[model samples]
Target: MIKDRFSDDDDGLQPLAYNMSHDEGNAANTETLHLNVLEDVHIFTTQFELTHKLNVIQKAALLLQSDTSLDDAPGLSVHEITALANETTHKWQQPWTMYLTIVVTALGAIGQGWAQTSMNGANLYFPDAFGIGSGSARDNFTVGLINSGIYLSNGLLGAWLVAPLNNAFGRRGAVFAAALVSLLSNIGGALTQNWQQLLFFRLILGCALGVISSTLNIFAAECAPAVIRGGLAVSWQMFCAFGIFVGFIANVAVYDFGSNAWRLQLAAPFLSTIPLLILIYVCPESPAWYIKNNDHYDRAFLSLCRLRNTEIQAARELYQAYLQQSTKHDSKDKLTYFKTLTELFTIPRVRRATVAAHTVMISQQLCGINTTAFYSSTIFLDANFSKYSALLASVAFGFINFVGAFPAVWTMDTLGRRSLLLLTLPLMALTMLAIGLSFSIPADSPAHFGLLAAMIYLFCAEYSPGLGPVPAAYSAEVFPLSHREIGTSSAVAVTSLWASALSLTFPTLLNTLGSQGSFTLYAALNVVAFVLVFLLVPETRMKTLDELDEVFAVPTRSFIKYQLTVYIPWWMKRYVLRRDKVELPPVEGWRTEEYQAVCQNEE
Candidate 1:
């Protein structure tokens, strides 16, 4: 009966003859047998039904001797077969290069964070240095324009400019270029004589930030093992929070510098960038990118060995697996930049991923994070706090933001991306509502200020875990390896555009709508973000980049219909008409002709 279930018709469990002989006459047979075993093992493990009896039987067969017949040899028990499979599937220890890569990328993220948040505190003093009256409309508009310039260049340069750089020179080169620009921009900004010159330098710095932000997470994701990829990739945001924290500290340290304080604050970010430039040069190029884009198989294999802590054979096999999966979606011919960009929208799964990436980026910005981050001190100042007290509150907020990000690194893989977003979005919404409502109380009341401070801290805590890191991690994970650079660039571009709009408009909104209306608008936007994430974004935790392709390639209508049938309550299903049920073909199977040929040749 057991044999009947694993009959010859079950191609997955075909019998294999082991060839352990060292004799010259049997060398051909031994090679053929080795290839057969490798192919069968690959197919069996990749299947979904891991616990099938036939699957266990196949594993048992793999350990058999060539001279012994199945009938003569003692059959392995189910427990023994399961143990073998588990042993086979266990991952190797990650290499030191993996950790090194994480550190290098996080450093780049710190530079980006410094560039973004440095302006937040410096804006407070800009009016004094620029000779504009405090609280004047012209001063507010100028500050907004300076902040908006960074984001505007981030959108344009990240999407169109940095993408090709990533493709041309690899992640390390891109980061190096970004660091150089940041160094120059910060020095230029610090030495500027007027607001106009400072704005120009800030715009240049934004372009550098765009390159760093768009590429660093992708580099981390590509370099890490799949088991911990989410944690490592999301570490970019943690470093970003760290950078912001450092900026806040810099502001506090230089607060007494008077007119020159802002200049010191602007230049402080270079401390992070200087080390980043050197370390990035020491890091290796992404193995996946090397294999796929550059056609340097030997170098890719070596890089894989270093990154995964495995031997040459294992590295080669793994790289081949990655190449096979990628080739299924990528074109055989070389893709130009425009063609790659077009493929992001033209391909079905890619298009869905792009939509999800863009939505998450846009939603994160529209949630009013930039407004809150860039103007927290100003917000407190408006609440009747002294300048020193407001700056202290900003420092506290930055600390909370940095600490909050640590939990996501622990929970991101366990909680799943969609789950984290869903869990946090509503809480963020409520927190914003609380902050808005606090403004309704008299500004002179201690209760009003206390509630406002507490709510702002709570909001930062809630936001850092999900909205801050998950979007960047998710966007990096969702795209195909061939298009990951452009896809992530596009997502960052959307973030910058939305950030630009918010940065440019938030001051005006605060002036016109008052604190209550501004906060309420953010709260409502969070509510809408919740709905979009719930409906569209898919779970991507603990999955490899290639596996995500199949996840998104499943037809949307069919997936929705399946969800309605299986997840919806029976009572709810009864109200739905059978005519409305979507009837679509099942997902196209993953096995390609090339894979089949390889399997057949081995057999």
Candidate 2:
């Protein structure tokens, strides 16, 4: 392989054969006492201590099997690690890889997109024929429930299904399943004879979309090597933005043509699959998933090259990491569903990151993305927009959200997390208040102008640049690798709870209090959330996941303080920082030969 490379780069690193299973295993174990370059890589014979010895692959496998924390590792700076990671990861979003992700994403989006439109007919316009009239207080409540049902259901079912299925079917299979669910469920909703039937399809659609949303993110992450993960994952989020946009467009189109528009609307998302399905036939699955689990090294390596757009030799670092993860699957206890969550919380850094991530996500919903997405059409109609004009206004919300993701993708590595959140939260709160205030004129008053339309577009569009992508990104990144699945799931779960509660109840609340009261409450929540984010959330951009463990291994007043304490104060982050230096996490204490059997018991 290139005649023992690194010849030009004088870094004193050496490669060793990565095998542990052998007849001389006992002899190797006795010699497993590793040497350390003490305080700063100096050879320290005195500090050497006896510890459980693991082979190179075993140590590397710990990279994947460990929690999401990347706060510490040997021989690399935190910024260097994060930069390398972001560059490699975001590559999955390139035209080729992204097309696959988008196609798979459509399978999930179909159900969600259709659900968004199911209530527009009854919600937007009262019947103009015969005795049909404007909806009273009760009709608004009924229509609102129909609108918000999907967001609520996605969060509830996502945690329960996506992880389990992803673990079972590989990322591609899970996403494919979601798309199939969408195709059937959307058609079902379109044909439903009554609201109950529509609601049932809506909930099913939510579950399907949740499955897709959760898995596709991990899918995008895995399919990507290391360079382009952020941009690609954000693209997946951007697709969701447009999914809502497509929902708005369906409402406008149907309103323009048909009288009973809801039927036509429910079928809109199914049409998105035409191009998406074609891509899936050709898109490669996650190489890490394939290599680690299926033991198909040749295919996984080829896919990795395509994913990274580089030669296989250049991808040695990632390949080695995959090897490390595989060793864990062979040697460690199987990660059961319940214990998975237990480890997520019990670990110090993971728990901290989970709280931080969940806070940002919960705040995003509290910022009113759902109310704006689900109710903007109704609001425009109430504000005196023409039949199809309101739908156009609603579509504008989705457009802003879609475009809003760009700046975040560009700046995520450069500007860091806390700076963006601090920058966005206050403005989001203020803009939301402004939208509420513009509609305060009494219905009979001359001041009842059409500023509501302008206010909403401004509110939805501007808030998106900062808050739209930030919460989603923070929610995913702030967790350690080990607990990433469970920790992020918990955060998403909390956000979903609020999203569902708001979606299910907002219409009734709006009718009872009037638009002024409803909007005002949303604005107030934004203010409270803004305060919480500023005081609590840490700057995580450009920091390795393990280094974050060093920074936040313990509680602190703020993220900066955590960083300071972890590094500067007393080697306080010792446990997370020096994982190789510490005792290994408690696995089943058994002879090496019994390793696979212990995992079998858990499985």
Best by TM-score: 1
lDDT, candidates in the order shown: 0.74, 0.59
Show where candidate 2 strays beyond 4 Å.
Answer: 1-99, 102-122, 125-141, 291-299, 323-332, 442-450, 556-603
lDDT by residue for model 2 over 1-603, one digit each (tens)?
112211122232332232233224335532232121111111111122101112221222223323312343222334434544554465343446545555566444443544554454345532232122345665555555556666667777765686678678877787677778877887887777766676788788777767766676666666654555555545555666767776777777777556557667777777765455455546777776665454555556556656553332223444465445644543324767787778766655666676678778878888887777777777766767665777777777667766776777777777766677667767777777776777777645545545665567667665655667677667777775556666666776677778878876877787787787788888899888876776567667676656676545434333334334333333433544654453322122223345445334433
| Number of the top-ranking candidate, with lDDT as the measure | 1
Instruction: List the RMSD of every prediction in angstroms.
Output: 10.1, 11.9
After the best TM-score superposition of candidate 1, give how far the Cα of residue 11 lies from its true spot, in angstroms.
37
User: How many pairs of residues collide in each model?
Assistant: 0, 38
- Compute the lDDT of residue 114 as modeled in candidate 2: 40
Cα misplacement distance, residue 569 of candidate 1 (Å): 5.1
